[model samples]
Target: MQDYLKPTEIIDWQHPQVLSLARDLAGDRADSTAIAKICFEWVRDEIRHSCDYRLNPVTCRASDVLEFRTGYCFAKSHLLAALLRANGIPAGFCYQRLSINDDGAPYSLHGFNAVYLPEWGWYRVDARGNKLGVNAKFVPPEECLAYQPRLPGECDFPEIFPEPLAVVIEALQAHQTWDGLLKNLPDRVSVLNS
Candidate 1:
């Protein structure tokens, strides 16, 4: 995907934080899959998920997830992607439409990331709101397509992030690549780091 291959606007591949952490992660030594696993676990436990829209962008980088961080799922995924990309791993953002009931309606939708694992193709990970696997209203790890979003600001569910998920999803459906997904994202994705 040329989109994924192009440099990113949000992730600072040159920051000392990025360089130091990537170096420490065992470049070229550890298998890319293992490194991807390590990065996934780091994101899983590190960032606190929230829908806050303003925070320092520099710190908002995924590296901050380890230092001091809070963000919704997309923000969290950005950080995870940055961390992996640091160590020369190719990572991409994934989106899905999930139908939910309870936020004053019969249904709604949300998005999360599916990181590209060279050996694993793409592995889904949700790093926001709460851990899954219990009391999930519907089947999770859902395909990005095949569902619907209810309304704007329907922030009733404890999900990985908040809306405008339609922007990214539509882009993915069209471009079938990372840059495609990013084309629809805000100039700067928001975050909360308190």
Candidate 2:
């Protein structure tokens, strides 16, 4: 919990701009859940998904995401975590392996978040922004992830991380363009059969 709230190189919740935005979004909200929801929606809608918009330059740092107004799932998750932590809510990264197009082949790692609410313990949310077929919500007790594993071998990784995975950060830093980053995005180390 302390690790989740503390500022990190990637999460960087303590950045002046990130702190300011968090204060603005969660303004006067007494409830942690309410504050978390406010922060989550702002990141989901305000920041455009880089891959979705085909934007270039992979933004990894939370401040960079705020400045560019765009990032991939991993970068977006960093921003969301920063916002929540800035508001004093514990937030962490979560990942899932999804088969593109929901098909049973060609999988890639997808990023989201897990927030620890005092009342609810911990809940997951995807701030990747909504699309025609994908809708992620801030509801608790029930996760409204953008995509669920439909294939027998696809599954969500339940580890709630204090910061972005090093492998993910390295992958983002290795590419200058979104297309390159998307093309060689990280994959799960192993798949679970369910």
Query: Using Cα atoms with residue i matched to residue i, what is each candidate's TM-score against the true structure?
Result: 0.55, 0.95
Q: Which tens-of-lDDT digit does each residue in 23-106 have in candidate 1?
A: 666555677767766666566565655433333232334545446565545656666667766776666664433323325433
Tens digit of per-residue lDDT, candidate 2, span 89-167: 9999988888765767677789999999999999999999999999999988789998887786577888888878777
Per model, how many backbone clashes are there?
1, 0
List of clashing residue pairs for candidate 2: none
lDDT over C-alpha atoms for residue 190 of model 1: 27
Compare the candidates by lDDT and give the number of the best one. 2
Which stretches of model 1 miss by more than 4 angstroms?
Answer: 27-29, 51-67, 99-109, 129-194
RMSD of 1: 10.7
Candidate 1 collision pairs: 62-79
* CA-lDDT, candidates in order: 0.47, 0.88
TM-score of 2: 0.95
